[model samples]
Every structure is written in C-alpha cells, then in structure tokens.
Target: MKRETNRRSFVKLAATAGLCTLASPAVLAGSHPEQLAENEETNKIPKKSWYPLGVFKNPVLESVFLFYVGSTWQRLSDVGECFDTASRIDEANDYSWSDQWIKTGNRLKVLGDACLKEHHEFTAGESYLRSSTYYRAALHHYPDPANKIVKELSLKVVKNYKMALKLMSIPFEAVSIPYMKTELPGYFFPAKLKSNKKAPVIILHAGRDSWAEDYLWVAQQAVKRGYHCLLFDGPGQGKVIRIQGIPFRPDWENVITPVLDFLKHTKKEVDMNKTVLMGFSMGGFLAPRAVTVEKRIKLCVANPGVLNWTASIYNGLNQIDPQLLPLFQAGNYDLFDQKIEEYMRTSSYVKWGITDELWKYGVHKPSELIKKYQEYNIEAVAKNIGCRMMVIDGTGEEFSVGEAKRLYDALTCPKDYVLFTEEDTGYLHCQPGALAIAYTRIFNWVDKYIDVI
Candidate 1:
C-alpha cells in the first residue's frame, strides 16, 4: 500500500515517454554499415557534459554518488561523512584517489568496530556496509588487476560485507552453490513471512564489474514486496573470478541451471514455478540468454537489454581503434594486445573497460576476448524464450544506446518495453539516481504478470 502510494506520486511527476520499438527481422540481421560508421565517428569525439559534483570532481565520482543514492538515503551510509571523505581525495591521480578511499574506508571500519564494542548493533552494521561500499568505490576506475592496493581493497570489501551481514535485521545465509569443479558464492535473503506458504523468488545477478554487495539495495526492495531474493557471484563475477580465477563463459545457462537446481531442491520457502531471473548491466545479456534455455524461469528482466555481446564489445573498442577488428579476425592477438595496452595507458576509461574484460574473460589478448564475446549473441536464441519478459531502457544511455530496442524486437514471447526519460531522473545506466521509480515500475509489472504470493 505504501509502495503503491509512492508509485502513484512518482508517476504523477514523471513524464510519459515513447518506447523505441524495432520489430523488423532485417534490421536484426546485423548492425548497418552506415550506423557503424556513424557510431565510430561518435566514439572518436569526446563530448563535455555536466554531471553532478556531489562532493568530488569528474563525472565518474558523480556517478558513484548516484549509484549509492538509495543506500545513502536509507542510512546504510552517512551522506555527510561520505561527502567529507570524498572531498579530501585528489580526483586527478588514480592511485592517490584509491589510497584516500582505502584510508577513509579503514577509518569507517574502525568506527564500526567501536560501535559494535559500544553495543550499538544497528549503527555498527550500517557502518560496515558503508565501509565496504567505499572500498568498492575505490576500485571502480582503478584498472590494474595486479595492483596490491586493488587486491587489498577488494579483500577489505568482502570482509566488511560479511561483518555487516552478521548484523543485518533480516536473516541472510552465506551460501555456496555447486558449479563446475569449484563453488559459486551467494547470499540468500528469505522473506519474513508469517505463514508457511511458498513465496515467489527473484534471483539477482550483477554485470561484469559489479559485485553482489552492490545489489543489496535492490534486494531490500524485493524483500519488502514479500519476495525472497538471491544475489550471487557467478563465474567471472566478483570473488569467483577475482579470487578463484573462473573466467566468464558465454553459456550462462550452465551457470544458472545449477543455481535453479539448488533453489528447487534446497529452498523450501520458494515457489519454483514462480521464480524470476533478473540481471543488471552485462547480466542483461547473460539473463536473457539463460532464460532461453532454462524454461523453469517464470519471468525475466534485462535492464537495457543486450542483444549482441559482440556489438557491445565493438562499441567499447571503437573508442580506441576501428582497425582492431581485422586484427581480431586475423588472429593477430599479440599485436592487438600490445596496441590495446598502449591505448589503455593513455585513457583511464578505456583502461578500466578493457582491463576488466581481459581479467574477467581470462584472455591475454583483446582479440581473444572479442572472439569469446562472439559466442554471447542472444538474437539467435531470443525467439526461444518461453516466459514473459521486460526490457528497460533509458533515453540518455550512451553505452549500448540502441541495444534495448534491438533486443525487444528479437523477442517473440510476450514482452513489455519500458523507457525512462530525463524527467524521471532515470535516463542513466540502471537508473542509478531513480531506483525507487525504477523498482516501482518493475515490481508492478511483475505483480501483474506473475503470481507474487
């Protein structure tokens, strides 16, 4: 009832926008040559834009602030404290910026420990989560996987997250699901239902660079709606890849099938037939791909639907060199890797994007990585999806701007296309600043199509 009221208020203030619908099979065949050329030209030009400053310089820091908007407002973080700490960092120097983040994060951890000692459990829990968030923010744009500071901060993030989990209000289980030879780690948050009746479950996963902890805010929203939420670190994700060396594979069905098996057999509280699969960022591609093969999923949602991983890779690569494609197809990976590394050294954004992919894909060369991404195309498989689907897109999304429309057109199953505009304060990746509005629309759709209770 409260959420419904909030949704109505939001809808009243938000402007209605048209969805970019594409249904032609010919257009889905491939990216048009003319459009590719235009995209190449657009990538070559760096446009100056105004992003919120919050307490730091540059759009990256502003994006970070927006990403944590829900958490900060919910008291998981002290907004003033975060801003004060961020203000001290020298944003121009990556190493210095990361170091300041680590220092601030450590200070927060100490404060959290002090709060625990003083018998302030709620304060301590919130502080630990905030500390982990800060540590993760430190690594956001820092490219090198081998940097000792990066490794140290990553470990600290896990440590603080685990500490916070122990003190959270709702019961959460740190679970290890059987996957391949090794295990995949996850957190399962069951709904606090008074009855023993089965409840619908939502399995949430993150993109290439996001960790499971980053999804807590969204999970909390789902839990409030009486759904059990499972957030996991699959292959090539979070600690699984960062610590265990499991590279990403295009066949996410293999990964998600096992998770489904675990839930069906293990979680008695969950309604297996009502299970929904949701993925954010790169998971947009991964989730839909899985749902095509895994029919047990009742519903699927892809935030900014990704139809082709190859196109996504090319979009990022085009910023560096359009000639790189021939090198990839020709198997001249050694030269390609060298050139990419050289380009990475000059551009922080490129370095972060490319290096993260290389590490996650377990490839020594950019060409090899691109070759692996070629297997992740979903257009060929989209027609096979049996469940209802939702594709969300933002009008101002620069990365994969046309992807949602392409993916929507390819899907033959019952589907809904929702577009967020600047008026809704959600025309950014994953609607970072307007999650409340985003979740309202998402869950409302879920309730309409799927039985929630």
Candidate 2:
C-alpha cells in the first residue's frame, strides 16, 4: 500500500475560521490502537451479565465473542467513559457540571473554528457544533426543571442547529429520534430536504454513543456533491440510548420504517428511487440490515461497519475484567460510590455498568436491549441486500476491520473496498484518516453507478 507520509500537512483547516486541536495518537503512543492490541485480544467484554443465558445461546454476544479478539478501541471505550461524565453534569445550573458542559461546547467550537479557518474542511467546526447540540439536549433533561429547562435548552439547540446548518450549501432539517413513542426530549437535527427534481438520497445511521449531529462532516460533503442526506439517531444511539435506555433493535424495521415513510411522503428532492443507506461503527451493522427489508435503499455503505453487536459489546466488556460483571448486569449503582474518574479505572468499560447519576435520570439496562440484538442478526439478511455496496476500512482502525472485510467478501452486490493507512492519514475511526481522500473516493464511486443508471 502506498502510504501518504505528509499526513500532518494533509490535515488542512477550512479557511480563516479557527484552530482546534486534533486528538492525534501520534504523540501518545499508549493511546494508539496498535499499542493496546494485546489487551483487546485477551479481554472479552464479559457476557456473564450481558448474556444471562450464557454466551452460546445469545447470538449477538456470540458474535461479539468472535469479532473483538484484540482491539484498542475497547480499552479506550473504558477510558472514554469519562466523556459520559460530561453528560452527567448539570448543563444549566450546577457550576461544576455547567462549566464542564460549557467548556466542552466551547472546545468543540474551537475545533470547528479551526476547521473553518485553517483546515478549510471544517470537520472540527462541525464536531464542535455537534457537541454543542448534545450539550443543549442534556440541558433539556436537567432534573431541576426549575426554569422550564426544556424551553430554555430548546432555544440553544435551535441556535446551534441553525449555526451548523447555515454553513452547508444544501437544504437541512433536524429531528428528535422518537424513543418509546416520544421525540427524545431535547435532541434535534435536520432529517430530510425536498429537492425540486429527483436527487439521490443518503440515509445515515449513527454509531454507538453518537447522534445525528455526528454526520455534519459527512452530510456537508454529500450536499455539496449534489446528494440529499438524511441523518437520524437509531435506538441505543446518542440520547435515546443514553437517556431512554432504548437498546438497539436488530429488526431495524421498527426504527427506520417510520423515518422512511416520513421521507417518502414529505420530501420531493429525496429520490425514493435512488436511495442509499450508510452506517458507521454500530450503524455499519444497522444499514446492512435495513437495506434487506427497505428495498427503497438502492445502495449500501458501511464505514468501518459492524457485522455483530454481541461481539462488539463482548469486546468492550472484556477490557474491564469479569470481576465487575455483576455491577453491569444489575444496571444500577449498587456496587461502589466511586467518582467518575475512578469509575473510569475500575469498571470493565467505564460506561458498561450503569451509573447512579444515569439512573437518577431514568437510564437503566433494559435486558431486552441485549435480547433485541441477539434476535436481529444481519448475516441472515446479508443475502437479501440486492443493492450495490461499498465498504471503507482504515488499516489503523481497531474497531471492526476483519468483520468489515468478511462482510465485503460475503456481499453479493457489485461492491468495492477502500483502505487507508495511518502514515497516509490520521488514526480516525470513521475514515477520518484522510477525509478529503475518503470523501473523494465515496463521491467518485457514487457518481459511477449513479450517472450510468
């Protein structure tokens, strides 16, 4: 593979916006994916609690058992649990929590500014806007309700959404992924845009611990290239997963059908005839499954796709050791009263076990969530995906490379596989390795099958 050695130079910003620091593992070797490979190989995200019936009977956990043999992202999932602590903070009043939320939002803004001004790509700026959206959503659910937090938070959410939306060239929309029937309280982002003529549509499914906002970078790219993008949060994603305890549903029919129906009825620009569904991380698994049933999806794209959720969870659980399995299984903070930082060190993967603050917010492990994944295996549906497909994998990504390759080989569609190296780009999970290169490849591929048809 030809490596792009001028990675730092290639990491450009979007004009004179601002400079935001990139979390490059180049300086921190321990944080690099390759460094933590040994732990990932041996440690299994314990199915002890994840699979009350044992790993064999549970297909999802069984799949997880197969995939995450050795991965650094699982270890980082433990450490990165610290990011959730920010969610635990009070965004409106509690000074400590509020300050943290503000700082995080501001830091994201700085990142966005850096992208807008320096990189010209403005991914950091989009990231900042995305984080701001989450922070505002958190405020909407603040326990106090002293000041009608929802109303106050909605204003900020709208502001951030508008700021992010204005930067793009195409029409944008926001949506609150309905969870258990209600629009997830404060979370919102644009969903679909109406085009005068038939325009190719992109349906985006978010990854674990992600929201619709995470797609700002990808959506912006799609719109500029003349595609209408639909970004939505699925169950167990973003606030719905974190706040409502709605675990993922493998029979994605329940989650995406309504969204598709809405698009079919509401948007003219969305070419129902030329739609593609794309997923990253967990969505990698999700988009594939959706395409099986939703024939409206003419093509599928899995960016660092996931074939098995059980394996994903098990891999994550393995990093923390089996001793703490009971705490995670119980789904409450009955075990220890450790602060968030210590919780990071002690728990198998910091967020695997439910926290007290989280429970106080009504978050709990609905065991059904795990069963949902177990019940909905995509391999059974892979043969059903008649659409042409594409899989993008980074050599540096630790999450699901082998699994993605297996799916790519199994897929019967006219498909292509794109790979990236760290020396050529940064170590990013969703092909952020060299985004310009990745996006170029994606658009070029779409143009090929799209125009000829």
Candidate 3:
C-alpha cells in the first residue's frame, strides 16, 4: 500500500510534464548507426528492440536502459516510461526527464537492500515474508489471479516458492548486527534423485547487469542431479539490490553471512559443509571476496573472475564515442538537448570509467572499492582458503583469462582451472551456452578434492 501510494504520487509528479509518447527508430537510427551490422537496416529498430510485450511501458528511456540492462520486459514498460519523464531534462532538446528511471531503479534497489538487511535477521520472520511478497507483487502489477502463468505453477512449486519466500520473510534485528549482513537474493532447489547423504548445495552468484532469475536453469540442472541450490541477488548483482538500489560493498563476508547462517540453521536436506559458492562475471569478484572470510564456505568457484574492476570500466567507457565526454564531466545535458546521440554517447552510465552508478547506489568508485577489495583479495586469501576451488574462463571473453589462472595458481588448496575455447564450448563470460560443461567441470573438480558425501 505504501509503495503503490508512493509510485502513484511519484508517477504523477514525474510523468505530468511535456512528455512525448513514442520514440521512432528513425531518430535512434541515425545516432546508433554504428550499432548496426553491415547487413542490418541502418534506420530500422533492431529485431531485439521489438518486444513481444509491445515495449511494455515507457518507450523512450526504457529503450536506452534496455541496451544497458540487456532489454528485459519490465524496463520496456510503463515503469520505464516513468523514468524517462522524471529527470530534469534539457528543454532545448525537447526531453523532459534526466536520468530518472536509472535513479529510480537504483533507489528501489537500495530500499530492497535495506529491507533484506532486516529480512536477513528474521530468516523465518513472518513480517519479512509479507513485506517481500508485497515488494514482488508491487513490481509485477499483482498479476491477475486468473493469469495462466500464475495458474500453471503447480501446487508443489507454489509450496516451495512460498516456503522460500517465507524464509526470506524474516525481519532483521539489531542484535544480529555484529555478524555479517550480506545482501543477496537466493533460490532454493531440492535434489531430484536420491543420493547417499544430503544433497550438495550450490550457492549461485551472477554478474553485473544480470538478474537472479537468470540462473534458474542452472539451479534446475543442479536439482535434477540431486543437488540443492540457492541463488541470491547479492548487492549490485540482482533485483534485490541491483535494479532496486543496493550498493556494492568490499566486505562481501557481510553480504554472504545471512544466507550461510540461514542454510546452516535450517534446510535439513542440505549438507552445509558440502556447500560451493559459484559466481559469474562480476560475481567472480563477489564470490571470491566472501570466500576468504567465511571459512564455512567450502568451495570458491568463478566463471572468469573480474581481477581489476576499475580497469574493466575504463575499457568499456573508452570504447564509446569521444565527443560525449564533456557532458559527463560537467554533469550537464545541454549537449543532450542539442543531440540525443551526443548525450547517450557521452552518458556516464554508458561509459566505463564513469563510476556514477556506484555513486548513485551509495558506493565508492572502483578505485576506492578496490581498496576494500584488497582487504578480501582473493589471490592473497586464496592461499588461506582450505576448501577446494574451481575457476572457469572462456578464452574469447573480453575480461581477463589471466585472473582465473592467477587465482588457480595462487590457491593453496586443491584447485582446477577449466578453459573452454570457442571451438570446444560456445561460452563467453560465464560459459553462457556451456553451463552443463561448467557445472560438470566444477563438480568434478570439487569431487576430486572433497567428498560430496
């Protein structure tokens, strides 16, 4: 009720101005020509832009942010429309909003992070469940009771989802403050086939611009093999904090502590000691950060660990148009008014070195965060980690393959590095298409070092 009231009030304030309805591909085509392939139409919207849902909500800003967030249905909708109109835009350019939706998403992520921080304390708390369910329902338009997707969820799946949601409902208490209070969303899956002992638990972490739901297939795969899995949207990772507004922290031990404690306290069918932490892309950075402090975490695995966060951002930003840099440095949109192409090209969020999102989410720049990163330095702590480890890297990945090797070499415990070439596995970043291979390699490596039984 509070959220709906807030959204309605905010929507009125944000979208009531001189706003435009739809953005023609013709406008975007001229500026985004470089994005087109040689065979593609220079003036047409890429096939990727035509959503089955008819651009869901706001067509303007969602169109832009979609490129950044990988074009999900929600951003293409009305919520996104709100973002396009909320910002203080340049009147000269005929745009009403500034960077509004991105900020909204970031703020929601922050509030969610705060809520989860409380939820972490109340792992089994009733209020937390009520609040979280409300949060999700609010986001999904409280899907109609007769919706087929809602109907199709079997009672068993519904029960499990509710069970997990119940676990997530627990409210945070002040007394639990001393312990780590990590912010990550999790998915729980029970093993399918029976095993000799409790099922192995895989803690899933995804990369930047990735959602927790993105790894459902992975958890499903693990479940089929009698492995229990938990996937959480950690700070800066998934919906709980990424799109909602939670900031990244260097001490990931805090981010992971809640889930680890939850697993240890409940879940009889799971062998907490058999737990493995797996991360992809930026998660490569996150999982390693937590593994060092949480000794109970049994395995540290990454799909191409991001060795240098700052460097990566720098590279991404440098690849964009050079002319847009002035608008970003000045934090002015005069150039945007002159030309939409100029503004987006130079947008700090669209640039690499521009750490605006971190700031927007209440985090320090990469340079500062990395200082905290050094405290949990995976390479330095790899020697201290007593658990088995696995590192997977795609040869064609734009990020460093060397970091994975460095981690593999530095790990004092038993470790394995599995490299998949384009020829062998069509994996880039998190072994995208080769998840089966990735899982097999990880389990095989872990089995060799520590018995899952």
Candidate 4:
C-alpha cells in the first residue's frame, strides 16, 4: 500500500515544519507531564445512555432503525424484533458485533430474496434496504479491516444497496466526479416535485467511517424539503479510501471545489448561488473546513462542529496512555505503535478507533497518525468563511466536548449554534436518535438562510 513510503515522507515534512520535539529525550520524558487521573477528571465527558447499547450492543445498527423510522425501510416493530434478536447474543468481548449484525442481516436478506421471488417488489425492496443497512452496520467497529468477512460484508452492502436503489420510488443517479487523476463516487437525488424548476442544492459528505449510503435518511429529508441532494464519498472516505487508497487530506476545499465546479457546469437544475454544504460526524469538520475557502457555498451546516482534530486525538490519547506522548515526541514510532496496539487490544472502542484512523489516514505508526491530525484544524482559517454557517452539537457529545462552541466563537461570518438537549433525546453525537427533530431544525435553519422551498 506504499504506507511505509507515505510515513517516511510525512515524517520528513513534519521535521521540516520544526515539529521534531519527539526527537528530544527531555520532551519525551517530561512533556505534558500531567497526572492521567487529573487529565481524565478535567476533561471527563459523560457517557450517553444510548451509546453503549447502540454501539456495543449492535455496532452502528441503531442509527439505521432510529433514522429510518416511519420510512419504507422498516417499521418500529421490525426494529424491535431485530433489537430483541441482538439482545439474545452475548456481547463477545473480542469485538464480534460484526458477526452479530451479519447473522441478523442474513435473516432479513433471505426474507427479502423470498419476497422478491414471490413478486413482492415493494416488500422485497424495503427489506433489502434494511438488510443492506444491517450489512453495512456489521462493518462498523469491526477490528480487522482486512478480514475476509469484512470484504464479504462490504460487497454485500454495495450489492444490497444497489438492489434497493433499483426499487426506490425516488430517482437516484450513480455519479462519478472528476478529481485529481481519479474520480469520486456518489449518488445524486434530484428534488422529486420540483422536477421542472431549478432548486437549491444540498451537498453532503460523510465523515471518516461513514459512506454516502449512510446519509439516506438525511438526504431524504432534503429531498422532501424540495432540495436536490448530492451525497459523495471524498478522499480518505468510503470508496475513495477503500477502493482507491486515497488518504484524507486537510485541504478539503480542493476536493469540494471540484464538486462545486462539476455541479455548476453539468447540473443546470441546481441553484448554485443558494447551494448548501452539509457534513455529518467527521464531515462536521471537513465541511466547515472546506467552506472556509470555497466562497460558492452560500450556507454551511456542520452537525457538531469539530474545531480541531488534533485536540480530539490528544484528548483520546491522554485517556489511552499519557506516556505515549513522550514516545511520539522522541520519534520512537515503532515502540509507540507497539504500545498503542497493546493498549487498543484491551478495549473494543480503542481497537475500532485506532484501526479506522490508521486505515483512513494511510499511516502505519500511531505517532504519525496523531501528528497528521494537526493539519485538520480550522482555527486559523475560520475567518475566511463568508457565508452563513450553522454549528450543531449535542450537549453530551463526548469526542468533541467543547468544539461546537469553540468553532462558533471563531467564525467571523454569520453563524448559528444549536445544542440538542437530553430532554429532546437529541443530545448525542449527530443527534442519532432524533433524526426528525434534527432534520426539522436543520432544514428550518436552511430555509431561513437560503431559498430551499
């Protein structure tokens, strides 16, 4: 994968940037010398009642059911059935949620196939979509990215997704946007009712681990509100990383610029002047970062603003192993990687987090990966944003504790901050359990800022 070559080049670049504190023994030994307990106490974030069950119980499974409620995919009773089935399986400590989801997904897939054979297209399509969601869910938090099971499940996710696409009532077009040397894959859903009129476009991109398919719930919302939705997989994300081996870049503006150019030149039905860019999860960071330089973006929405990727990594690393910082500063990347891998082996959360980051960032060593996060910060560039911005965060968001406020404060442009609270059951990362409320607030904000109706 040329990972070693990339690592060498990155380290050389870091050295040129005068970030060689890792090479200093004194820095390695005493840098950021604070008690681990004190650090934890100072930065402690309360765990959500839904997360442990949602992530550990089913591993990326609940969001599908939660977001798709009242939609064609499945009913609440069906979701309850799946949840009940999941509850029967012992939560395997070895991070076997992948296997659990696959088992349940296969059951739904079989039912869908049977329905298809019986000429029940609507039932078959809906079940297939649900099964596809479950298949994709299986890959989340799966420790071994290179496992045969992962590949098998990934292929099924795409296959079943295509099956659902074929049967969906809404028009969906598979698109490939020209980028640097390669192409970015995506799906374009044009506004159904506004077929004869030019409509505002909402461009959405997923974060580090999510794919374009995962945004179906939100995209449907945009479509319902008479906005054309374009959901694409950018660099270091989805097919771009999985198939093309492109690592994530800090300058997302370059990626988005091409997309904007494509939309302007090709899709004449899209109202470019009223275009909005929306990002979820890590996209919360990537979207806003792109808008800082891309002036064509009239409105930007980041669901939980990510002020600095480095801060999040540093906080997580502090919780994992404060001593590892010294190794990072000392440039002993091999030892650092070994220690971090050892620590990750003890927890599923750490395992998934590190493995996903390593894969997405295309770095071999833990220190190199952490260092790469420094480039993703937007503090220095926030003032460049000239459009209306919306920053969303859950009051209980763990990873990006105070990032929403920090990002909002830094923005010199017109901006709005929304904090979903526990009483609304929207106070979790990206407001997973409250998609309706989130979308209502999001589109209402969008309508207020732009002509989306």
Kindly report which residue stretches of model 1 are placed more than 4 angstroms away from their true locations once superposed: 1-62, 148-152, 330-335
Return the top candidate by lDDT.
Answer: 1
Per-model C-alpha RMSD: 10.4, 13.5, 13.7, 9.1
Cα displacement (Å) at residue 43, model 4: 28
By lDDT: ranked, best first: 1, 4, 2, 3
| Worst 10-residue lDDT window, candidate 3 | 13-22
Candidates 1 and 2 compared: the better one by lDDT is: 1
CA error at residue 376 for candidate 1, angstroms = 2.0
Off by over 4 Å in 4: 1-78, 93-95, 193-196, 330-335
Kindly list the per-residue Cα lDDT of model 4 for residues 1-453, writing each as its tens digit.
Answer: 453433332322222121100111111122212333445677754332433334223223333334323233423125564565456545555455566667777888898899999988878877778788777666654667766666667678778777877766657888899999989988899886544578889999977666788778667778888889999999987767666678899899999999999999989899898899998878888999998888999999998788886786565555445676778778888898887777555545555556667777878777788789888899998889988889998764655668889999999988999988755767666665566787889989998879532
Please write out the lDDT profile of model 1 over residues 213-284, one tens digit for every residue. 887876787788888999998888777876777888888899899999999889999989898899887788
lDDT measured at residue 301 in model 2 versus the true structure, 0 to 100 = 83
Quote the positional error of residue 362 for candidate 4 in Å: 0.4
Query: Which scores better on TM-score, 2 or 4?
Result: 4
> Per-residue CA lDDT of candidate 2, range 281-342, in tens?
66777787777777766777877655664554334333333433345456544442232234
Candidate 3 residue-wise lDDT, 149-265, digit = tens: 322222222233344444554111111211334334455767754545686788887655444545555665666665777876666443544233555565677777777787777
Score every model by TM-score: 0.83, 0.60, 0.53, 0.82
Query: Per the 3 Å backbone cut-off, how many clashing residue pairs does candidate 3 have?
Result: 31
